[model samples]
Target: MNRSETFMEPENFVTFELVVHGFLVLIIGTIGIIGNIFCLLVLCRPSMRNSINCLFIGLAFIDILLILSAFVMFSLPAFQVYVERKFMWNVIDVYQYTTPFVYPIAMITQTASVYMTLTIALERYLVVCLPLKSRSICTYGRAKRCVFTVIIFSTSYNVTRFLEYSFETFVIDEERGITVTFLQSTDLRENPLYISIYINWLYMVFMCLVPFSVLFLVNLRIAWGIRQARMERSRISSSQRNEESLAIMLMVIVFIFIACNTPAMISNIMETFQIQAVKLTQISNLLIVFNSSISIFIYTTFSRKFRRILLQVWHRKRPEDDVLFRWKAEGGPNLTGNRSTRTISARRGARVLTATTSLEFQREISS
Candidate 1:
């Protein structure tokens, strides 16, 4: 395990690997770009602009960047045709020359996306579990600042990546003068200590374990808060219900992160232990990409506001019949036109509970 390790290029093209990775890159990248863009469009709306939505927009933006970068990284090699080997080799050469730069951007964007998700979970946890404190802590201004800090931290932190990896050309055969391009780590090529610490400790512990653990625990608190509020129906105002729904969506996203990212995390750890995990790493990478790509679907499915806004943007038609919730900072009762206010007094004998939206009031009245 103390010995230096490096990635060496294969002498011959592994058709299966190229095909599989290419397919994943093509499919996932296309889906991710489209979905993230749609989410961006929906969340960017003034109605959706808020502290939590700010984090989501940041996450979507980072995910899009990561996906597009990964797409180019994976798809470049898939175009290798026997007849066009010369042309493709030139393409590979260009990619290899750019690997040092591209890898850092990918790493930084991926890290930012993860932090953004964690920030989101933290925001939801506070909003659901500690509503009053969250008001001050989870302001839109604060969220924007947090996102900027995350980007700065991720970018600055991953600067070490430039020192870690480089593209090296290796001669596989001298008779035909066959050469292959490889992405090798300088630290791994010269000093094994760096990767041992970087991957095993910094990446496994700080990047993977700590974040996931915090997300899991925070989401658990959010869920518990929701359950407790539901048990005492009167404590659950329309705004609180909205918080609960948002919490559920956040929890689902965290679950997907754990599910999609666990394999890659484990693979990195396994490699650190000197277990041969190249295939596992490749598969895990696909899952990681997929995890990043598929989040928009979760947002669209779980958030009605997201869907309505999407439809509004797409069709240029407002479906007024579709129920909408307009959350207000201050709770009050107001009546205008056909809209009416409804109150559900808390069983604990609280004085009044106000609905967050006209739609919720109408529904409660009808029910």
Candidate 2:
């Protein structure tokens, strides 16, 4: 199908799609931008700086870029088409030409995001499975280097996509005198066999399958490590426990990534096989965007320290509230439970003082 037809298809350009993709997508993209910014703000704090937080900060930055790209490339254009009867072909042309360049950027960000996740997983694995070495390997400096390396390699790998697409003018309707310029694949999309093999097999396997498998297995290993440590009564320090929690938080994000991207991959495979799954493809794209948008929420849900600190920084709570928050955090009295070590310590101290005073008085009388 041609770009015009694909964009303005009766099924594709229905009111529902206009409302969803045009309006709702912009909202989601905006929220994602803000959410990721908040993540950066929270994760970049001196107290929050760690190897995993470094990876998370990188992921958040990439997600922000991805959301911005989606807004410019997809959501804004769709909104323009929905609102303007006389759509500017020039704008669309620029969009078309911009896509090949943007395509590589998006892939670079996405691939880097995936690799960062893998890096986090590996860091977690080392921390849990090989605690002694983890301290040496999972330093913030090392994490920064890994993130830099991932970005460099991913960008290098996908830069070829920019050259693989170029714009060509195609006549949409001779009677109506409509000619539109749209992006066309140079050789890969033109050749059926090449497109099928590259997209269906190679791209799917490397991009989706390998990453998904690695994430799943690594998370399973983390879970097993946690269980084994508990069973063996191994002394996991507070920092190690925090690392495990962070891994669990990232595991949820990775699961969302798999869930969101799998449908898109499936649709790509079906399209390669000449199967009709346009709706599935559209829905999958939305889900992928959503996946990119919701990581901050997942972090908030899993990390109490994140939530507390975020609330403190964002809302600027009162000093009393801060004291209360710290008390609760330190296992003092809380709303859900009332057993407080502070109260126990206070009572124990008083009893000890009374017993010492009585013993001293009795010793003085006997002497």
Predicted structure with the largest TM-score when compared to the true one: 1
Prediction 1 TM-score vs. true: 0.76
lDDT of 2 by residue, 74-99 (tens): 66656656544445444444456567
RMSD of each: 8.6, 11.2
Q: Which residue window of length 10 is worst by lDDT in model 1? A: 1-10
Error in Å for residue 286 of model 1: 1.0
For residues 250-280, write the lDDT of model 1, one tens digit per residue. 8988999888888878887887787876556
How high is the CA lDDT of each candidate model?
0.69, 0.69
Q: What are the models' TM-scores?
A: 0.76, 0.75
